[model samples]
Target: MPLNIVLLDDEQHVIDLLSAYCESIDAADIVGRFSNPIQALNFINNHPVDLLISDINMPQVSGIELAQSLTRDVKVIFITAHSDYAVAAFELDVIDYIVKPVLLPRFLKAISKAQNAISASEPSTKELGNRELSNREQSARYIFVKDGGVKKRLVFDEILFLHAQGDYTEIRLKDKKLLLLGTLSSFQQLLPEGEFVRIHRSYIVNKSNVDSVDKDHLNIDGQDITIGKTYRQNIDEIF
Candidate 1:
């Protein structure tokens, strides 16, 4: 039987691209494509799907949260522009994590892994080979951010904090800073929740890099940043 698959991403273009890719695969069937994670989750709950291709960052619900909420045994493949969510994806035992600006060849490789996983889970009529099909890798400890058309790899340990700068975000490192064209909320969803903390509406600090903390502000690398009043509760818990 062909694998029943569903696609979910906030971008309609992404949904279209992934849908076309699923159609190209001989053993896959495109069951649905949704821009809303909640709608996709509801569909998955009411239907039988073998795989879910999802984007990590969404408005109402994140793909990671959606995968965590599922009670069924559906394999997931995360497609996103950010690699910060790699740790969380691996924790969820997703079939693959494909970075965005997704090339067709790379996407095909991910689909192949999903196919192997689905096949392995079924009762085989003949003896299967001993070839290992697992795709889990060492959790990613860094991410590549595109700056001025160049991809700059930044290790997680080197990052001090992320500050929202209008339409872009400033990534503060140990020595310098880089601007990325995305929102703070997007990065918040990308980074591992345990390592990064949202101290304010405009700032997300690397908890390990924090030097000190007070009621109104926290010091990271000796630079004090204001803590939002609404986020004071989280700061209280951390301190």
Candidate 2:
């Protein structure tokens, strides 16, 4: 039987591109395309899918959550614009993650990955995988944080680190910064376990950005930061 699949993305252009490709592919049956995550989730619950092609960043809920709910029976290939989500995406055991704006060849490669995952035997650590998948699902790869009345969606990969000050979280981006309403713990939970570590109670740094680490000090992109006593052991393993 041809693999039954669903494609979910907030961008109509992306959905149009992927839908066309899936229709052209011989092995897949393009079941539907949904811009809304809730609608996609409902459809998946009512249907049996062999594979799902989804966007990691979406409004309200993410593709990660949808993938977690159907991981046992369906393979997921996430499409995202950021690289930081890559670590968490892998942890979820997604067949692949295709960064946007997605090229046709790359999108096809994701489909290939899903096919392989479907053919592969069930993994031994289903429960552990499920739990890990849930954490990654709920974690935000792209945050729609509000600065006053203005709302902005920031990709997590663009953020250098978050600085906590009382009730607000300082979002330091690659180019600029934004002071948003959130806690340090909330940002930490959104980051992948091995890829991001809490260097201090108020700071979460991406391991991929760390230039060097010795004892209590960590150098990330020429910036010096200290490792908290509580997070020392965990940081050590990553370095």
Candidate closest to the true structure, highest TM-score: 1
Model 1 scores a TM of 0.51
Tens-place lDDT per residue, model 1, 145-182, is 56876888877788899998854789999999999865
Clash pairs for candidate 1: none
Tell me the tens digit of each residue's lDDT in model 2 across 151-198.
788776776777887546887777888886545654554455566678
Clashing pairs for predicted structure model 2, backbone only:
none
What are the TM-scores, per candidate, against the unseen true structure? 0.51, 0.49
Q: Candidate 2: minimum summed lDDT over ten consecutive residues — where?
A: 122-131
- lDDT values for all models: 0.80, 0.73
* Winning model by lDDT: 1
